[model samples]
Every structure is written in C-alpha cells, then in structure tokens.
Target: MFEPHGPKRLSDIVTGDETWFLFFIIPPKRLNRMWVDGQGDRHVVLRPGFQSRKTMFTVFFNYSGPLVVDILPQDTTMTATYYVQSVLSQVKSVINEQRQKVSTSRTLYLHDIAGPHKARATTQSLWELGIQVLPHPAYSPRLGTM
Candidate 1:
C-alpha cells in the first residue's frame, strides 16, 4: 500500500471551501453495493470477473460488477504528469457539480495525497486551482484517515 500521512485540520480536507480532494479506493465488494437494480433497490451481487479489474489512470473498470473506480494510484508511472492531469480533471468536475448542487463556493483545499506521483503532481495542479495543500507527516495513518 502506498500510504502517506493524513491531514490535521478542516482546511486539510479542502471540502469546506467547496473543494476537497480526498482519495480512496473501493474494491469490488463495495462497488457491488452502489449498483441500481431494475426494481430500484441497491443490492450486492457476486460477479465472476470482478476481482480481475484493470487499472488505468486510477480507474478500476470491473466489467463483471459495478463501475466504481479507485482514484488512488496503485503504482508510480513514467508519465506521472499526464496521469495526474487526467485524474484531477475528472475529480474536479465531479466535485464542482456536487458543490453546485448544494450552492457552495468552488474553492478547494487539497490535502496531500500519499503516492509519490500524487504528492508531486496533485500538489502542483491543486495549487494552480487555488486549493491549499495541507502539510503532512511522512508516514502517519492519522493523516490519511482525516
């Protein structure tokens, strides 16, 4: 696991300004819970190829099951800048839409993510987006949980 220290303050989450970049991963089990059924009740179903999902640009597309993807990077890539750009763009869009639904400001606070590439690229990109990046320790689970 590419774990990094967690955030310490509300600003660390960046959501209050209506901008928060909290990264999490959901395996197939949790993915199964969000699926809508024909009857409109959510149910968990066992899918054969759910465990063999593919990771691309932080997206875990499991065809046999739900389509939820883990936004955390599982490994460092050669072209980290591009990867970060793609992930952040998608994340920012979703966040903006959600904030708009609640009529909130789009100013975000991006707590530093744990992965090496995430640390480097996300920080730079978020700064450009006017989100404050909280200071974090090197290897503390407390930061991640917050």
Candidate 2:
C-alpha cells in the first residue's frame, strides 16, 4: 500500500512568525459574542499593570510540527537585506534538511505580508531557491494558521 500526498504537510501549508515579547493581550473576537438570554456573563481582558520587556524570534512550522527557530540579535531590524542575508539562509537549511523529497513537487511559501518578507531582495532570494510564494492578504489573521 502506498499513501499519496494529499494536502501535503508543511510543503503545502506552512507558517512562519517573527514575534517580539510584547505583553499586550488582544481578546479574540469571540469574546464579544454574547447570548442575550442572560445565559453568559461578559468576558474581560485586563491590561497588565507593568510593561514587560520583549524578545524576538523567527520560527517556521506546519501541521506536523516546528521546523526552525531563529532568535534575532537584540535591537536588530529585519530589513530586506537582513532577511535575505540571514533569515533566508536558516529557512533554506530547514527546507533542505527537513523537506520531504518528492519529484516535481511544488513548495509554496506562505509567509504573511510582513515588510521584510515582501521586499524585492527577499522575493528574489526565494526565487533563486525555486520556491513559490503564496499570495497573502495583509492584516488577515485567518491566513496565519500557526
């Protein structure tokens, strides 16, 4: 018996995130949904009393699990130059080592429309690697499934 690749794994659907340790808590929209029959009480998210420091890291993973985690140097800005010069290399290594081998298969890169991710140099870097970019909408959290 053989298993045909269906939706595929991270090769078909993948997510990468560059997060800073900002302590802001955003309540999900579901919190606003209230049953008017008095069956539920209003939910609230309290703001933190003290501001918290932040740390930044870039990570890539898919339905199966995590693939890469690259912590950025403090105060480092992610520009097209920096991304192509640094981030792309790490991602390439992950894809090279962890990606499933299938002939004539397509790899769709589904990163969000972040400034660095969309820069021309970054796009060119991906192009050189023969990875196709997935069209992404800005501010669309639904597309970010990680």
lDDT (C-alpha) at residue 121 in model 2: 90
Q: Which stretches of candidate 2 lie over 4 Å from their true place?
A: 1-11, 22-52, 103-105, 138-146
Candidate 2 lDDT by residue in tens digits, 1-146: 11476554444555687988665555566656655557766665454243565778888886668877877777888788987778778777766666557421356778988899988898888888877777886675777796
The CA lDDT of each predicted structure is 0.45, 0.71
Report how far off residue 60 is in candidate 1 (Å).
13
TM-score of each: 0.37, 0.62
**What global local distance difference test value does model 1 have?**
0.45
Off by over 4 Å in 1: 1-79, 101-121, 138-146
Give the Cα error of residue 76 in candidate 1, in Å. 9.2
Clashing pairs in 2: none
Q: Model 2: what TM-score?
A: 0.62
